[model samples]
Target chain A: MKARVHVMLKDGVLDPQGEAVRHALGTLGFDGVEGVRQGKVIELDLATEDAAAAEAEVREMCEKLLANTVIEKYDIEIG
Target chain B: MKARVHVMLKDGVLDPQGEAVRHALGTLGFDGVEGVRQGKVIELDLATEDAAAAEAEVREMCEKLLANTVIEKYDIEIG
Candidate 1:
């Protein structure tokens, strides 16, 4: 099975890297870009064949290492 | 309007960060991890409501600033 994880900063958190991108975009003349938020997408190739088990295991991975639970949130999709 | 962009390194590219993650996962006792790849997901809030135009603009952003185009490929999703 394959697992895809998207880890994003939680709401109300400040993202300086995203802010820098937004500012650079504005400077590049692409106006009307009101906001920007950046996150991580991790793709994992697992040895498991069961989708349910893969999802559960990937979720555990997220909680243990993939995501910073206090400041970030993660979503997992198993295929 | 909103646009979501997923930027990933090309298949042949070496991803040290992902390798480190995979190694860490093994050390943490999460076995059966065959491989790992990492990417970026960027969300943009646009002032325009037209999805078509938003997609086009975001594509331009990717070609010009968002993606390296040499080692990275980006996909745009307008919502």
Candidate 2:
């Protein structure tokens, strides 16, 4: 099975890296970009075949290592 | 409009960060993780309303600044 995880900052959190991107875009003449939020995507290839088990395992991984739960939220998809 | 961009390293390229993550997972007892690939997801809030135009603009942004096309590829989704 394969698992894909998206880890993004929470709604109220500030993202400095995203702000840098938006500022750089403005400098490059790409106007009208109101905001930008940057996040991480991790794709994992697992030996397990059961989708449910894979998802559960990946969720645990996210909680334990992949995400900073206080500031970020993660979503997982197993296939 | 909103645009979500996913930027990933090309298949042949090496990802040290992902390798480190895999190693850490192993140390944490996450066995059976065959491989891991890490990527970036950027969400943009744009002032434009036309989805097609937003996608085109975001693609241009990816080509010009968001992605290092030499070793990275990017996908853009507009909504």
| Each prediction's whole-model lDDT (CA) | 0.95, 0.95
Native contacts recovered by model 2: 0.99
For residues A12-50, what per-residue lDDT tens digits would candidate 1 score against the true structure?
999998999999999999998999999999999999999
For candidate 1 chain B, which ten residues in a row score worst on lDDT? B50-59
Query: What is each candidate's DockQ, to 2 decimals?
Result: 0.93, 0.94
- Residue pairs clashing in model 1 are none
How far out, in Å, is residue B78 in model 2?
Answer: 1.4
**Clashing pairs counted in every model:** 0, 0
Candidate 2 residue pairs in clash (backbone atoms < 3 Å) = none
lDDT at B30 for candidate 1?
Answer: 93
TM-score of chain B of each: 0.96, 0.97
For A1-79, candidate 2 gives per-residue lDDT tens digits of 8899999999989999999999999999999899999999999999999998898899999999999999999999888
